[model samples]
Target chain A: MLNLNNLLLQVIRLLLTFVIIFLTLIIFGVSPFDVFESILYGSLGSYSKFIRTLIVWTPLCLSALALIYTFSAGMWNIGIEGQIIMGAVGATFVARSFLGDDLISPYLQILMAMFFGGFWGLICAILKIKGKVHEIFSGLGLDFVASGIVIYLIIGPWKRAGIASTSGTDIFHKASWVPTVGDSNFPIFLIILVLFLYIFSLIIFRYTSLGIRLKATGINTFATNRFNFSSEKYIVFSFLIAGAIAGIAGFSQSSGAYHKLVPSVSGGFGFLSILIVLICSRNIYFTFIVSFLFAALIVGGSQLQIKLGLDHSLIGIIQATFVLSWLVLQKIEIEKITYKQISKMFAK
Target chain B: MILLENTLVTVISLSTPLIIAVIGETISEKGGVINLSAEGTIMICALFGFIGAYETDFAVVGFLCAMVLGAGISFFISYCDINLRMDQIAVGFVLTILCINLSNFLGQDYVRINGPLITKFSIPFLSDIPFFGSVLFNHSLITYLSIVLIPLSWLFLNKTSYGLAIRASGENPSSASSRGINVKRMRLLSCVMGGSLLGLAGASFSLYTKYGWSEGHTTNYGWIVLAIVIFGGWNPFRAAVGAYSFGLLQVLAIKAQSVTLALSQILPLLPFPLMIFILIFIQYINRDEIKNVPKWIVAILGGNQPQSLGKKLPEEIK
Candidate 1:
């Protein structure tokens, strides 16, 4: 029954978002029918387009999965963006080294990316636990610093042949690149690896004692102490896991899609994943479906830029509308409860 | 002497918008609400303020429009926070991203377009006072208003009855409600007022300091303003000082570029990490676990954040 209600709520939120998007289209002087038709055709019209959608879907899905762990542990992890960047930086460092020696393995670079991303994530978690700083502020501050670090590297030390452009570092050698299927940008093995991880997470979330303890820590930190569970350890553990997953997402983007470390390599995928996770309400299955749809939105939104001269950022507006409306709907549901009932709920 | 005077003038001019923004955020936080949407709000307002002035050719109209937009966004945040009992941080974060993207999409046509700037007005007698005249007496009207806002906000927050109500609402809403203070309404009013000031700050950016709108313009300043509020301990006077100091650092970062080629680009990033360090340092010195810290050190370094700052008010109060 709860799942049914959640499904209903999701449908309502989706409808409201479409309505708002329609209105936005009108404001942009585009026809709703044409835009909708184009969006449908653009994202899934051909086999290649579907593959493109899946390519975008991969990183977004991973980021959402990462967020689920952090959100479950009651940490905002707003620095996921920074963690992703650090992952790219880690990967870039390895790839750049390979330029001098072509024999270095690609798998080691991916491992190093995860290490760097996890390290960055640990910094935010440690700041929260040890420094008594709020995760939101510390994470945000770290994000700026992380981006600054990237800019410094790209424009300062890592400039391609004494020419510093926003175009980013010199491309990695072909051997260092993630191998993709013939003429397709999708890395088939990496996609399978992520899918396996997603299944593993689902099992962990449903059947593992650690998952239960993490949820308990989120619900009531004091309750965990009574059960001899260290809430702080779980919090830190969740952040590390999330950061590793986000790091891999960053690695995939750098090695798979761009094949170079551009300043916008993350492309707001970190923030976009937060919206997807929120819409999914922390369910892994729901996250998989929603991520694909959002990926389609991104691909389709880019198509709008080509076909209708609309700004591609329209996708962000649409995503924001969906999340904002969902928040409002959740608020309306909460407002229906009486004060006495809420007090009783709190007491429990 | 001339270079120092010029640097001082630049610092004050650059600090105006930050001062106004920090004061605004301080007010809202004092009333128990956190507007994390300040970054997006500033960006959106800057774009709209530019568009309004460009079309109407009136800077005042542009400023007014920005304020109204700011207030409207704040009202939405307050509604979600107070009426729905939603998390303010989550709502504000979403709003921040939404407003930023919306502004970018809508402001594409207005980018790099020339518009009327806010006119600078020099004080009659103060303008003739040598170094001080050039440094302090000469600036846009918005800068003067920002300067006035420092003392005005301090007096209003400290001395007024409404100020007491705001503080009470933030500190202990349930008790404040029991005293017939109407905690929700006070928070709503404070949020709107604070949001208006944020709008003014945005307008000041476009009309006075930066003098035009562009993508990612006023991007990270909102987060800096947030840090400044905490650094100021939510005090208006101290917050203004924090803003001015940040402005000085920014000016120095630019000037330091000529001295070193490689570190210059990295120099500007120093304030962000420094702010984070300050946040941690303040918390470390204040934690009760650190018993070795002296009482006077605690008194000086420990910021007394409102007791129930982010708590949801009881449904009965609404």
Candidate 2:
């Protein structure tokens, strides 16, 4: 019965979030129903486009799941964005440097890319734990640095011999790229990646000692310290895990969708991961759903602008509003609890 | 002579936002609130300031409107964090993201529109002084206000009754409450006031410097200001000195670009290292000083009130 009540409250919160989003869209002169339809039709309207949307959302879902692990440790790892970029940089360097090697297997190359991405995230984690710098600002600063590196690489070493605004390295060898899973290779890999991230996150979050320690640290570091756990170590570990996962996002976007490393390869997937984690309230399972919906919105929002002459950035405004409203609503919910437990039965 | 004048002008102009924001933030921090939302406040103010000045062609109106908007934004943060007792750092961070996107959305239309820039004003005799004349005396009223406000703020905090109340609240909320001070009200007002100054700083960027709006125009000034506040050890005069020093480095970067490109780019990163060093120094300094102060003084100035103060104080006083 208590479980049911909690479930109901969560559902109400989710519904409230949707309602708030709908109202905000109305203000922007876009009908919520139209948005809903567009998203639905855009994602599933054509088989190829649906597959494309699913493919695009794969790394995004993985990154969001990775974020849950870090967030559980009570660290707002804004550095995930930088970590993802670093991961991409890592993957791009690896692919470019050794793509023609005869001894390197395709699967091994992909694995190496994944490892490189994780390593980039670990760098951020180490900096956070060792340097005693707040991850938030450091992460933002690192993003600029990473983006700068990417820009430098493109204009310098990674520049294609002759192309206008190509601004990136040559395409990866076919073997280094992740082969499509089925007749529809893109959708199949997308499905596999999403399921893998969700299941892995679910198991890790529910069944691991590190996960529990992370959660404990997130809630109260002093209490966690009382148990003799090093919150800093857990935080560092959490950041590494988050970074590695975001790195996979970078790797997947390049290997699966773009097939070449570019400045826009991740296309703000790192940032979108924040919104997904927020709306899902840090639940791994719900994050999967939110990532897909968010992916659909990105796909549809652009379509709406192209077809109807609406501002594409309206999606950003809508997403920000939803997150902001949720923050306000979350505070109100907390205020209703704890101190004095203001009764709803009292006259309004 | 021209080079010196330009360098001085650049330093003062760039320093204005950081100086104002740092000074205001010093007040906010001394009141026990670490407002990471300073970035958001400045960004939103920058956007709104551009809109106001572009629409009205009046610099003061644009600045005033920006302050009002900044105060409103900061109020939400203070309301949530202070009154509701939510996590101060988390709320401020969230507001930072929200404010940035909100300003960016609104600023899309206003970006290209140019507003009248505030021309430099010279004090009669002060302007005639040899080296200092053009460097310090020849600037807009806002720049002059910064010059006065630093010392004025220092006086207010160290000498005034209200400053005492603010310091007391920061030290111990419960004891301050016991002394008939409204801790929440003080913090809220401090945040609002700080935010307004930050807004004025933002307006000065567009109205007095760039004379046009652009997305991300605040360009991390907010974070730099926060770093400046900490670097100054939450002291207004020290913060001004910090801001001016940082401003000089920034100006030198541009002026000496022909000398060293790498150094020019890396000069901006100088503050991050300095901020970390300063934070550790202050922590060490305060740790030693923590023991010698009277319990009441500590309570009034120490961050977060002790649990004992609430029950020990007279019922009527609370």
Candidate 3:
């Protein structure tokens, strides 16, 4: 009976979430049903389109996983945007300088790229820990510095005379690229990797001491401290892990497809990750599903730009609407809980 | 030598909006409510402030319209956070995103249109002071209002009755409630007032400086103001200092472009690193007190304070 009740609750929330999505599209003067159809056909339209969604979904999934870790520990790091940028910067720096066209040894470059990205995120964590700065503001400030660094690279050190665009770094040889599966195939390997992450996260969340300790810290820092748990260290570690995952996502986006560094490589994936986390309510397995759904929306929404004359940003609006609705639902749940508790206390 | 004066001027002028916004934020925080929606308020006002002024050709009208827009938006945040009991930080963030997109969508057509600029006036004798006259006295009335508001805020905070009530609510809600104060109402008022000030600042930019509506012309002043509020220690005077310091960095960066090769290369980024370093320094100096300040204040200022909800009650009937 309890299981049935929980299942019913899940179904209601899912239906509410869809209603929110539909309402959001309607507000923008688009039909949700038509857009939904477009999203389905857009991703599965052709073999090539299906492959494209996977390419986008892989990095998005990695970053979402990283975000879930940080958010669960009660840290809101807006620096994923910059972290990803630095990842690409680091990757480009390595691929161009040392591993240019060397397919035999790109693995080392990839590892270095991940390190640099993670290292940048660590800078934010260290600043928060040692310097006492708040994570959100520091992350925001760091993002600006990172943006300036990218622009500086394009205008100064890595400027190309012939290319008029703002993009920096040179194009990589085909050999330096991360290998895709059979001809025009998406990276199916991501499925296996993300699945592993989902299972690992589920196990850790359900059974591990670290998970319990982290939740305790999140719920009540004073009580957690009384129990001798170092909340600060755990939070910093969460940021480090989150930053590393975001870093990998950045490196993947650049090397797997673009082959050249562009400013939009992160493509607002950081903000989207926040939405995915909220919708899934910090559940790792749920995030994997939502991230792919988001990828489909982006992949399909872009097609809407051409087919339905919708703005490219409609995807952002759709995602934002979903997040806002989830928040409303979450708010309702909190209200009910608070009402129950407070009413009882007042009764006493 | 000439470049120094030019840099000085640019910094002072550029820092004006942040100064105005952060001062309002300081008031909101002192009263113990966080207004995370300042970003949205600022952006929407910046967009519509231009539209109103451009259509009507009145700078004052533009400023007034922006304040209304900001206040209206802030009401939603206050309602959500207070009445609906939503997570303040999360609500503010979501509202911020909403305002950004809404402004972007609204301002898409207004980007090319220009608005009337607020005319600058010099105060009689003080306006005659050599360097200070041109740099300080020769700006719009709104800029001058922001300057005067600093000391005025200090007085209001230290010497006023309502101010004390607001501060009390922020410091200890239960104690204040026992004293017969309406804590929620004070918070709602502060949120709206702070939001209005931010809106006015957004309007001032279009009316006095940018002289037109641009989608991103506010350029994260909301975030910067939030940072400055923290850097200011939630005090209006301190926030002014932080604002000016940031202003100085922006000025120096622009001026250094003609003087050095490398400085120009990364000069735009200079303010960010400086802001981060300053924030870290402030946090280090006030670590103990920093933790003690209310969560609402931290949320309002966009600092790294925990997103606090009211304490949970006992499970069984009392």
lDDT values for all models? 0.84, 0.72, 0.73
Candidate 1, residue B4: the lDDT equals 94
* lDDT, model 3, position B317: 10
Q: Indicate the worst ten consecutive residues by lDDT in candidate 2 chain B.
A: B304-313
Tell me the spans in candidate 3 whose CA falls farther than 4 Å from its real position.
A1-30, A33-43, A104-106, A161-165, A189-192, A225-229, A333-348, B1-9, B122-130, B256-265, B287-318
Clashing pairs in 2: B168-B300, B171-B301, B171-B302, B172-B299
Interface RMSD of 1: 1.6
lDDT of 3 by residue, B1-318 (tens): 456666666777777777888988887777666676777778888888888888888878888899998888777777776776766666677777777777776676788665587777777888788877777777768888888988988787768887887676667666667788887776678778888888988887777656677766676678767767766767787689888887787666666767754465465455567668667655644566455656565543433321222211112211
lDDT of 3 by residue, A1-348 (tens): 379866766677667878888877778778988888888889778888887888788778888888877787777777888888787777777777756677653565456667877877888888877886667778878887877777777666776666534665677767666666767556655456567766887787789988887667667767878888788877777777777778778777777768777767787777677767867878877888889888988888778867887665566667777788777775566436757999999999
Taking every candidate in turn, the Cα RMSD to the unseen true structure, in Å, is 4.7, 6.0, 6.0
The TM-scores, one per candidate, come to 0.93, 0.83, 0.85
Q: Is the docking of candidate 2 incorrect, acceptable, medium or high quality?
A: incorrect
Question: If you assessed candidate 1 against the hidden native complex, which CAPRI class would it receive?
Answer: medium
Quickly count the clashes in candidate 1: 0
In model 1, the clashing pairs are none
Considering chain A alone, report the TM-score of candidate 3 relative to the true chain A: 0.88
Candidate 1 lDDT over residue span B1-318, tens digit each: 998999999999999999999999999999988898999898898888888888999999989989999998989899888987888877888888899889889989888879987778999999989998989889888888999999999888889999999989988898999999989899999899989889888888887789898888887788888878887778898888888988988887788777754466666566667667767877776665666878776554456677666666777886
Task: Choose 1 or 2, whichever is better by DockQ.
Answer: 1
